[model samples]
Target: MRPMLNIAIRIIRNIGNIIIKNYEIQNINSDYNEYNINLFTKKINKNLNNMITKVIYNIYTKNITFLCKKKFFIFKYKKTIWIINPLDGVMNFFKKLPHFSISIAICIKGKTEISLVYDPLKNDLFTAIRGQNAQLNGYKLRCDKYFQKKNLLFALNTSYIFFTKKKNVNLINLFVENLISLRISGSISLDLAYLAANKIDCYLNNNVQNFNYLLAGELIIKESGGLITDFIGNCNYKNSTNILAGNADIIKLVISKIK
Candidate 1:
């Protein structure tokens, strides 16, 4: 394992602890409403970003900058980029469902070199380094979810599924009509993590702009012998508005059926 990856693991675990602790505290409060849920999640996001920046800068201050949204914010320097999503699956978290995670991607020179998605609730840590295979809790992953399965487990955000029916969302409609089995998990990181861990066969994401989730996903999926591509079999997913990801065989079958 690379030394930088070691540091990233520590950071992930540290943040995971914070999430679990806060979640437990919030669970004890029965006055859970939409307003308080939003407030709690937002506050947690801000704290995570601050802690991540502080820790990374304390060591690699001169070599790292953060990629937030569509632009990079260079905090006094630049070389490597870190996209850290403080939290994913806000709805699940609010409903007290244990499906959220903290995702981090380290990109160097426009390429993802290291990735991690840690489920604080389950303590399942998925990680990958460039050129090395992905791992889940120390076991190597290989994108072979179907080896012991009977169905083609396709995953995406549930809200998109609802939008497809109500609003006729074309971006998401392109998938629901053509895919096999459906599994909706709100967190994008978990969708990718599930694919790597053999829990899902494919994941179609409508939004590709979130490097915070997708970049980290890209590294771990590829490392696990999976691939992330646009709807038409193109490898350049970052430039596209959406992405279709799975192992090569599933990807080929999916594209063949899309209009």
Candidate 2:
């Protein structure tokens, strides 16, 4: 586990350097090289997948399956499954918003065993192992259980607004009106990570199509004493599941407002 952590740190640091350097260049030629950001992201994604494959192979002799954005590689034995999101917030990356991250999780028979999410710009690494407390950097983290409407901060991902029903939008608006504030960050992984660290008290996502997006943060929040469930408060992971994550009391507050 230590070796894996070391490798992950190294990988993210290298990738962060690449992104920062490219972003500097993009700023100088923003008008002319708008499309270059996409190319840069593609290069980074390719390098990340290749590097992870080599690193994992060297660490374990057992067959492993690797899943990432638009690419899935399967090795024969499948004792472990590695799920990764090399660049989580590509849109933010292209916009040079500094809100993107790298997410990685190891699952055994569909249950996550280890999870990691790295924010390159902030150098924040959130990690959790099943049955162990979640950590930011090296310090243990736990969610805040207090549910105060006057002081609560809710992180929301409103990307699903186009597809969401009117009732759902009304429910979201209810939260907006009642909570102290509502934040919409484009990165779902970071939103969940922030929730686990108590930087935000709650997170709601209506369009999490892939488990890869939430897998790492899910474990982190859970190990940090946060509760995550579908819109109706069921602990099921599926493509259609709308994510609601926070401490137990906040989760109940969110569930109660869903119409």
Pick by TM-score: which candidate is best? 2
C-alpha TM-scores of all predictions: 0.83, 0.86
Question: For candidate 1, which ten residues in a row score worst on lDDT?
Answer: 68-77
Local accuracy by lDDT, each model: 0.75, 0.75
User: Please, what are the lDDT tens digits per residue for candidate 1 over residues 1-259?
Assistant: 4988998899899889888878787762477777887678666767767877788888775755455552222222455766667678766777778889888787777778888999998899999999988999999998873442235678875545435454335534545554457777888888998898778888886655555567787789999988889878888777787788898888877676564
Candidate 1 scores a C-alpha RMSD against the true structure in Å of 4.0
- Model 2: residue 59 alpha-carbon error in angstroms: 1.7
lDDT of 2 by residue, 1-259 (tens): 6666676567566766666666566552355364665566577667666766776677676645444437332332355666767667777777778788877777777788888888888889999988988999999998987777777787878575723677686576666588557788878789999999999988888777666678889999999999988888888746455788889987787788784
Evaluated at residue 218, the lDDT of candidate 2 is 91
Off-target runs (Cα >4 Å) in candidate 1 are 27-34, 46-50, 61-77, 145-150, 161-179, 207-209
